[model samples]
Target: MDLKTASSLHRLRLVSAPEAVSFLLLLVCSVLKRTTEFNAVPVMGAIHGVLFVVYVLFWLDAWNRTRWSIGTAALYFLLSVLPLGGFYAERKLKAEAENAVIASRARAESAVKA
Candidate 1:
């Protein structure tokens, strides 16, 4: 992919895992607050909220730069809400980046030959 697309995806990938983790942590904190003497929901909630927003922003940038189909965009959005989905998205993005690199190389080689 082009540098802008790659950078956007990379930022999204970076935020996604943390956002997922924070979401899980927030769940745990909620349970703790409800069932025990411990309460961390406020702090965890804020962290998760920021990360989630960052994920959305980066996701939008990636979508715009990559020009993904509606289905693809929806899939990414779905992944954001699932706790384990970010990891899968990261793997898929890596593959996409590799494909883009290969395609770029092929184009460069063709241009040289022509």
Candidate 2:
């Protein structure tokens, strides 16, 4: 992968953790609102909303930059809707990105020697 691809993947990974946390908070707040008088819904909703938007934007960027397969794209998209999916996405993306970097380096090294 090139620098742009690497950068886009990095941004997606960076946003994933916060997005997952916000989603969890939203879930907890919703439960709290139903179970008790405490209302954290508004704050949590706003936070999750912002994170979701950021995640989508980064997702799109990475999708455009990296030539991912349909299954890979589907997995990333599916994770957005499921609770705690962001964490899974983050882990998968980090490994993929690392692999991409290593592959790119290997290719470059071989090209230089050939």
TM-score of each prediction:
0.94, 0.95
Off by over 4 Å in 2: none
Alpha-carbon local distance difference test for all models? 0.89, 0.90
Top candidate on TM-score is: 2
Off by over 4 Å in 1: none
The sequence of per-residue lDDT tens digits that candidate 1 reaches over residues 1-114 is: 688898898888888788888989999999999999999999999999998889899999999999999999999989989988888888888788888989999999999999
TM-score between model 2 and native: 0.95
Task: Give the least accurate 10-residue stretch of model 1, judged by summed lDDT.
Answer: 86-95
List, residue by residue over 1-114, the lDDT tens digit for candidate 2.
888989999999999888889898899999999999999999999989998999999888898889778888878978987888989999998999889989989999999999
Clashing residue pairs, candidate 2?
A: none
Shift in Å, residue 49, candidate 1: 0.2
Q: What TM-score would you give candidate 1 relative to the actual structure?
A: 0.94
